[model samples]
Target: MRRFRPYLRGEGLILTGGMTALIAATIMKLLEPWPLKFVVDSVLRVEQPTDVATVIGLCAGALIAITALRAVFQFLATTVFSMVGGRVLTRVRSDLFAHVQRLSADFHEKSRAGDITLRLVGDVGMLKDTAVTATLPLLGNVLVLTGMIGIMLWLDWRLALVALVPLPLLWLATRRVTTRIGQASRAQRKREGAIAATAGEALAGMRAIQALGLEGAVSRMFRGANDRSLTDGIRAARLSAALERMVDAMVGIATAAILWFGAHAVISGRLTPGELLVFLTYLKNTFRPVREYAKYSGRLAKAAAAGDRVFDLLDQVPTIRDRPGATEAPAFRGQITFHDVHFAYDGGGAVLAGLDLTIPAGQRVAVTGPSGIGKSTLLTLLLRLRDPSGGRVVIDGTDIASVTLASLRRQISFVAQEPLLFSAPIAENIALGAGRDVTRAEIEDAARLADAHDFIAALPMGYDTVVAERGANFSAGQRQRLAIARAALRHAPLLMMDEPTAGLDSASEEAVARAIDALSADRTTLLVTHNLALAARMDRIIVLHDGRLAEDGSHAALLAKGGRYAALWRLQQGGRVRDAATG
Candidate 1:
């Protein structure tokens, strides 16, 4: 309820209107039986009537008017509830999506994409039906039931007692069944999420499954989850059906008891036949709410489970959020320093153990290390993807954590290995960055700088050509060049390239190397690569080994030192005798 309070903040008028309509409808329902009773006891039962046709006509007209009024109010109430429900849920869905997006990278690392989608799409959808059919209807019916029962007792207390005998038993039976259904419904909803996740995984990885010939394995996994979901759904349905039958039986028993007891009262002249008919009608009408409760119990249980899931998701606070008084960072000079930075994931072994390093503005540096030595961790820290456990990462002499994430990232242009390009026009892909508004000439100039304009122009639509998935339509070199073009257009002070020329053929590598050289000119660049040749070209080379800095100097200076950097370079170059002389 607290979770829903914000969404229902301004719904007072709609609820009031709906409540008024419900009361009017209930009054009309109570009056419906009176007209029939009057016809039976007065017009039809009179031995000497002055005008029989006129009396019958009046009674019939009154009955029709009451029925028509009830229908109108009922329609209004239903429409109001439906409108309120739809509007509230639309806001809820939008909020849920925005919250999910704001969550940290660490949360996404442990959570399944498909499960989140199910919560956003499936769980929220259940609340819609609950609001309309289960929630509002149950509330409205309770009020109607209370009013009708009072009228029943006033008509004849003894007959009302007979009618009420089976109610307590029915309530007890429904309570027990609904609890079990709720448990089953929760399990069923969880299994349905698993099924969705399995299908989504299979669809997204279908290419890999085909390549590895693992289709049968994936299919079997999906079947197991699908079967469990189906079993739980059927069990819930069966329990609901049983509860419905029990309510029907209780209704019948109450009806039978009232008929048997009330007939004697009327015959003995203790009650009029018209009054007896009214009491029976009230008894039936009072049970309408009970029957509704039994019928919607399963649906209500399902909605409760879904509501828990939705609120559970909404309750999760993002791990990385702006603190109070956090200020937006101004434009950076691109100077970077890691001051005794220590990082560990989930309290595991440290990836960076008390590492310290500094880079002056406008200096291009290359980072080289073996696999699992935290080469990529350095870039992530600079990007603020994850904060260090101990110490600060300062950019332009200000702690990055103290500044807004958007401001910090806007100044850095990153070109990741296997660069992600969307399915849009080539010009649009090139222009996508911190500030997306770019002129045509600016796009062409950036493309030319990255050595990509010639190939782009040779295409049928040139810059207007739409890329396929991640730019699979072009060669690897073309994709890398376009990524460089994108970074060039951003024109940020800092640029980070992770293995930009990796996994390419000789021709592709040469083309990408030229683009990297052009893009790095006069920029504050941090390059992570295993290519000794590329590292040799940087203004300075930093080598990381076993989560600590092992070497930092210009290529020639490191070679002269004959230290860790020299050994790595020699090993990659197969250590010629001429190279050994310099070492």
Candidate 2:
């Protein structure tokens, strides 16, 4: 409730209007039975009543007018409440999405993308729907119930007390059934999230699944989650039905009691037949809220579960955020220093342990290491995608942590190994690296520098050509070149590439290597790769082993030392020789 206050604050006026309409509708409903009571007493029971036909007509007209007014007010309340709820939820969804994007990469790494997506789309949507169908109507019914109860007591206190005898029993049954229903609803939501996660994972890796013929395995996984969700859903439905039926039985018992006792009162001349009819009518109306509650209990419980999921995600403070008093960083000179850096992932051994290294301004260096030896971790630290657990990473002698993240990251351009591309125009994808505005000519120049212009121009839409999902429409070399073009457009002082040519063919690797040379000119560059050919071209090569630097020297010098770098070079050469012989 407190978390939702900010979203509701702006809709106060609209919300008040809705409440006012609901109250007015409740008043109209309370007046509805009175006209029938007048017809029963003033027209039907009166001996030689004056203007009998006129009285009957007036009572009929009043009944119609009361119902029509109630309808109008009810419609206004429903519409206004729906509009306010929609607006509130829209803001919530927008904030949730932005918050998810702002969270650190570590949170994303540990969390399932599909579950996050479910909270964003499915859970929020459920809240919005339940607000309209269950929550708002329930509030309106509660108002009606309160008004009817007051009227019932005013008409005849004895009959009112008799009619409410089953109230405690109804309350007990509701409390028990609603608890079970809520539990079932929460379980159902969890199972549904699992189903979404499984389906999303399968679809995202459909190519791999098809290649490996794991369709049956994936189907079984999805079916397991789906079956669990169905079981929970059916349990909640059954409990909700039981509660509704219980309320119906209670309402029947109360009605029977009201009829028996009120008839005795009418026989004893303690109450008029008309007043007794009004009491019975109010008794029936008063229990309507309880009946509605029983009917919508499952939906309301599901909504509560959804709200819990949303608020749980929103409660997670971002681990990475701008520090207090952090200032924007100046343009970097590109001299980088890692001072005794120590880093580790959660529940894992150190990936980099007290490792010290430095690269002078405008130097080109390659870092090579065995798999899982923290080669890529170096770049992630420099980019502040994850900060070091101990020591500092300094750029131009300033601690990176002292500066705003946006300002610090803007000075570095990184090309990931896989070359991530979103669904956008080819030019837009290139321009994203700029992080600011860039002209068409600049984009084209960057493309040409990366050796991507010829291929991009050959496309039907040229620069305007839209990239398919993850740039799957392009070949490995084309994607790599485009990624290089994006980095080139940034024109940052420090450039980093992670295994950029790892999966490319010989022709594509050569083309991409040339593009890398052009892009890295006069910049501080750090290349992480296993390709010794690319490393040999760098000014220096550093080999990491067991999370510490084992060797660092020029390619020829490292080869002469016959150390870790030399051993890795020989291993790659042997693999190449074997491949060539097979060919």
Candidate 3:
């Protein structure tokens, strides 16, 4: 919580004005008790009746003006306070998003995406209220309480001491209960985010769960998540209730004692009847801030919890951060060289073991391997998504590890097995890399190159049509082609695609292949695919077996070698399995 203080530190200027107005409001509120004393003493007991009437009229007018001014100052103070809180929120989110973007691929491999998203949206929103309302107003209340206590002691020390009897006990209870509430609130918020993450993941993967007939299993899991949140939330609420009841008892006891003691004093003539009435008025006014403070206690605790969660996200140092003094890369010449490259996801055993390979500039190479045999890992290394554990990957004779991520990513285009598109117009997705310079002609030409323009033109809004989230409205092939169109817009020197046509039918695959060929004309491209026929069409093939390079040569030469490549090709084509030596 102390570390979370930076979220409030940027509001120095706004807090200055707010504190001034809050002090003004507090002074006006303090005027309320004195006017009751004037009414009791001057109008009822004074000698000259007309003079008393005049004095009373002036006090009434003064009191009315002060009450109005109090409202104005309170509004101005809280408004500025909220503005400052809003400014901090902007900085918090901006930093959080930037950190998320810089986080390494390996971090993503281990963390659930839905959990990350919950931190971004749910946790961050909760922190905003803490600064805007809870913390600042708490300060104002403390000041009011302090000023009220001072005035009460000045009026009569004996009466003020009587009022102080229950103060320590109430303060002690507040301290203990608020601490409990804070811890409970933080735990509750985490559980709440976990529930959202669980629900989001379940909803996003609903089709998969249904297709696999796991509806009951997913339901039970969601129920468990919901129950965890409920349990934690109930604990937080229980603490808040205890705090309220304790505060209520303390206020009741203090007020009753003041009246009991003041009555006897009025009877004894040490305190006047008018003074006793004013004492009662001050006793009630004293609890105004106390009640306000108690009311906001739960909200403040909840907000503190949320602020920590958001700051946790903001504090997450990218696991794969750029080294200090990293240099920017120029255009990629695409001569990718991996020298004794070794890597892993969690610093465990190497996933890519002593890999060594070099593909010349403008070479179109297909990497074929078993599902988990590090083919994708190789592409990750080449793209600088994860730096190698043991060696360097150099592009254009420059080690990629030394370059800035922005420039390194700029030189290469990546299309995953499934294209990730937002729910936006097709033109925006296709020309995503063009930023502010995306033109109609450029978007169409890129679309045509990916063989996606004709189908796009057939849509209701042509390129302006909105695609559903993750391109759900379009067929798989259409999404892939649109992805290619986006990559084509980059027109980068290097391209890396993973199983680009794995899920397409023959007709769809035909369209996808033509688009890829057109899009990757002169670039150095690495295509990771299990389709041996697609591998055969590439200029060269590298067959990976068990995290090692098993074969590297032209497809025809590898077929002639009668190795694993030839065996896979034969098996895929429904031909006899050859008893080949290289296999």
Candidate 4:
């Protein structure tokens, strides 16, 4: 409810109108029985047969009028409540998605995508159901019950007292069942999320699963989670059924006691038969809502469980958010510095520790290291994908953390080994991150620079050809080339390339290397690679080992000194300096 408070700010008018309509509907419901009472007392039990026809006609007309008004009021009330509930649901789901997008990368890494989707879709859907079927109805029922109880007491206080004797027991039983159902429903929702996650993961990795011959393993995992969800669902349902039965028994006890007392009062001439009948009818009408509440208790419990999960996710403060007083960054000169920077992922050993380095404006620098030696971590730090646990990363004299993330990242261009292209047209993919008004000429020029123009032109639709997810329709080399074209399109002052040619064949490697050289001109470029030949071509190469800087110099200078960088170059080239030269 608190989570929904923000979205309900302007809904007061709609809420008030709905309540008014519900009141009208309840009044009509109470009046509908009166025509029958009139017919019973004044028409059927009358002493004179004369004018009886007129009495019956008047009662019939009253019944018709009450039924029509009730229909109209009930319709208005349900419509208003449903419309408001729907709007609230939309706002809740939209906010949930936007918040998830803003959550830090580490949070995403630790969570399952499918489970997140469940919260966004399924959990919010449950809240919507609650608003319509439970919340709105409960509000109406409470008002109806209050009004009906008042009328019954006014009609005959003794009959009213007898009818309510079972109420305390009903309340106690409902409370006990509701508590257990809530717990069970929570477990049910959790297991449902697990089932969804398992199925999603398996389907997403279907290709790998088939290639590795692990279909049975994935199916069994999905089946186990599905079975748990079913069991929990059934348990919740059973508890809800029992609650309904308890409510039914209580209703029966109240009705029986009221009937026995009302009959005696009528025989004693203290109450008329028509009045007793009206009391009985009002009792049933009031308990009608109680029975409905008992029936919907299970659904409300499930909704509560869903709301808990949604709020829990919303409460997670992002680890990477712009600080207060953070200012937008100006255009960069591309000089970068790492001043005693330290970082480590949760529960993992240090990835970088007390690291110090600097890249001058417009310098072409290459970073080389063995696997898991923080080459990628350096790029992540520069992009602010994750903040350092200590120290600062500065660009053009501006501490990145002191500036807004969008402005800071806008100055840098990155191309990874695997590109994440959307399922959009090739030209759109090339123009991605290049701003909305990028010209066709600019896209073509970038494609040419990345050696992708010819291949793109060869396709039937050329730039209009739609790319599949992850650019699966294209070869790895083509995807890498398209990524390079995207970077070229950005033309940012700072560029980062990570293993751009590592997985490609010799021909593709040569093509991508040319694009890198063309895109790197006059940019403060940082290249991370295992290719010794590529390192030799850079203006300078920095080698990292055991979370510390091992060596930093030009390739020829480091080779001449025979230091760590030279040893790495020799090992990769197998002592063949000629092979390195050719590469």
Candidate 5:
């Protein structure tokens, strides 16, 4: 319900109208069964020959009128309820997606996309049935049940008492079913998420699977996930079937009691045949709703369990957020200083222990290190994708933590090692998440700066060419170029590049290097790469080893130090040249 508040506030009038219509419908329905009593006892009780036609005419007309009125309210109720339910679902999905867009990159590091996707897509949708079918009916039923019990007691108190003999047992059974269903549904959701994660990973890495001949292995994993899903579904289904059977048995017992008591009255002539007939009709009417409620109990349980999972996600506050009074940052001078900055992904060992450094405006700083040595993470902190565990990262002589995230990030642009693209045209994806009103001229200029203009124009449709899901049609180099073009278009004061030449052939690497130079012209840059030759061209390089600053100076200075940086350079250079020699 808390998760639904935003939507409820938006559709308040329509939701209220739905409640009103349901109340009217319930009243008309209760009137319908009473009419049956009148028609049976009044028309059929007469000695047939005398005025039978008139009697039939009056009762039939009244029944038709009352039923028609009931239909009207039922129609209104369903329409309004559906509208409200649909709106609520849309709002939740919208809010969830928007929040994810705002979340810090570090959150994505620790969380899987599929897990967040399951919550957004699967759990949020479960509330649909509750709102559209269950919520108003529940209120209507409470009113109907109260009215039915009152009328039945007035007719025959003893029979009414016998009819409700199984109510307690039915209530107890529903509780037990709810408890079991909750456990099963939660497990099912988790298994489904794992399956989705596996599928997502395999499909995203489809090239790797094919190259490694892992088709059979991947298929087996998918089959295993399918088996787990089916197993849980069967268990949940069996329990539901058992509950329904119990309700059936209870309805049968109540019916038998009605027949037995009515027979006694007939034997004594205390109740006429038509009167007893009407009583049986009402008894059936009473038990019909009880049967339906019993049936829908499973769905109610599903909604509850599903709702819990959804709300759990909705309730999670992002760990990183701007302070309440955070202000927009002023124009940066491009100066960057790291003062005693210490950090670790796990918050244990430091990645940058007591690190101290300063870069003058418009300087190019390259961070080079082995895999998992915090090169990428350092760039992450500079971009404000994360804040340091200790000390500070100051941009333009201002502590980054004091500025709003939006204000801070606007001063920098980044191109990741692997570009992420959307299912849209190349131009649109290049401008993705950028505000409206971006002109075609600007997009083209940015592409030109990144050395992608020539290739893009040569494509069949140029900038308008449709990019497949995640830009599958584009080569790795092309995708990276598009990413660079995107950042170039931003024209921020600082630019961050990470392994730009990764997975590129020699020709593509040269092209990308040229693009990087053009994009970073006269702008402060913090680059992370293992390409020593590339670092040699930079203004300076910082070497990180086991999360600590091992070396920092101009490329020549680091090479002369003859430590980690020099050793790595020697190993890489020898390997490349030796391989060339052997060939």
Candidate 6:
């Protein structure tokens, strides 16, 4: 409720109007039984009564008017509440998405993409639907029940007490079953999330799955999750049904007891037949809320579980955020320093241990290392994607952590080994790097610089071409070129590439290498790669071993030293020579 308060405050006036209509409907319901009471006592049972037809006609007319007005109020209340609910949830979804985006990379790495997506889309949607259908109607029915119970007590307190005897029993039964139902519903929701995660993983890796001929294995995994979800769902349903049946039996027992007691009172002249009829009507109406709860128990239980998931995500504070008094960073000179930096993933050994390094402005450096070395960790620390467990990274004499993340990252351009392109126009994908409005001519210029303009222009839609998911529509070379073009558009002072041409063929590698050379000119560049041939082109090369700097010098200098770098170089050169001889 506290989480919702902020959003609900803006809808106060609209919510007030809805509540007004709800109250009016409750009053109309209270009046509805009175007309029938008048028809019974004043017209049907009266002896020597004048104008009986007029009296009966007036009662019927009043009944119709009350029913019509109640319907109108009910409609207003329902529509207004539904509209408010939709608007509130739309904002919530938008905010939740933004929050998810702001969370640190570590959170994303640990969580399944599909489970996070389910919370964002599926869980929030379920909450919105339940608010409109089950929650609002239940509120209205509760108001109706309260009014009817009050009227019943006013008509005959003893008879009203008799009718209320089964309420405590009903509550006990509801508590026991609803608790189990809620537990089952929560389990069912988790199972559903697992199913979604499995499906998303399979879809994203469909190419790999097919190539490996593992369709049967994947199907079995999916089936397991689906079956668990079905089992829990059925359990919840059964519990809800049992509760409803219990309520029905209790209502029946209470109604029978009331009829017996009220009939004796009427015969003894302690109550009028018309009053007894009204009491009976109120008794039935009073229990309507209980029946409604029983009916919506399954949905409400599921909604509760969904709400927990949604709010849990919303409540999570981003691990990475701007600090207090953090100001925008000035234009960077591209000088970087790692002062005794140390980092490790959660519950893992250090990936970077007491690493000290420095790069002068406008210097191009290459980082080469064995697999699982901390070469990439240096770049992530610079970008503040993951903070160091100890020590700090300084840029241009200022600690990067002292500046706003947006300001700090704005001066750096990054190109990953496998760049991710969204399902948008080619032009839009390139423009994302600009971080500002860009003209079509500028986009074309950047594309040309990356050697991608020729292929893009040859397409039927050119820059308007929509990329398929993960840029699957483009070849590896084409994707790399597009990524280079994006980085070119960024025009940042610092450029970083992580094996940007790792898996490319000779021709593709040559093209990508040329574009990278152009992009790296006049910028402070850090390239991480296993290719010693590419590293040889840089001004200097640094080799990492066992989370520490093993060798640092020019490629030729390190090779002449005959240390770790020489050993790695020899291993790679030997493999290439063998491949050439075999060919």
User: Judged by TM-score, which candidate is best?
Assistant: 6
Task: Report the C-alpha lDDT of model 5 over 119-171, residue by residue, as the tens digit.
Answer: 78877777886766776576667767777777777767777788777877787
lDDT of each: 0.87, 0.92, 0.81, 0.88, 0.80, 0.90
Error of 5 at 168 (Å): 2.3
The parts of candidate 2 lying over 4 Å away from their true place are none
Off by over 4 Å in 3: 1-11, 46-48, 51-53, 264-275, 288-290, 347-349, 575-583
Q: List the residue pairs that clash in candidate 6.
A: none
Record all residue pairs in model 5 with backbone atoms less than 3 Å apart, i.e. clashing: 351-547
Supply every candidate's count of residue pairs whose N, Cα or C atoms clash at under 3 angstroms: 0, 0, 0, 0, 1, 0
| Alpha-carbon deviation at 60 in model 2, angstroms | 3.0
Q: Each model's TM-score, in the order given?
A: 0.89, 0.95, 0.93, 0.92, 0.93, 0.96
- What ranges in model 5 sit over 4 Å off? 47-50, 104-106, 133-140, 263-275, 556-567, 576-583
Cα error, residue 14 of model 4, in Å, equals 2.5
Model 1: per-residue Cα lDDT over 47-114, one tens digit each: 73788788788889999999999999989998998898888888999999999988888998888888
Per-residue lDDT of 1-583 in model 6, one digit per residue for the tens? Answer: 5777798877999999999999999899888888888877787784836998888889889999999999999999999999998999889999999999998998888788899999999998998999989998889888888888887888788888889988888888888888999999999999998998999999999999999999999999999999999999999999888888888888788879988999999999988888988888888777778888888888998889988998888888878899999999999999999999899888888899999999999999999988878998888999999899999899999999999999999999999999979999999999999999999999999999999999999999999999999999998989999999999999899999999988887788888888888889999999999988788888899999878888999989999999988999999999879977986
| Model 4 CA deviation exceeding 4 Å by range | 533-537, 570-583
Local lDDT at 440 for model 1? 93
Native-vs-model 4 lDDT? 0.88
Per residue, candidate 2 scores C-alpha lDDT tens digits across 45-112 of 74847888898899889999999999999999999988988899999999999999888989999888
What value does the lDDT take at residue 310 in candidate 3?
67
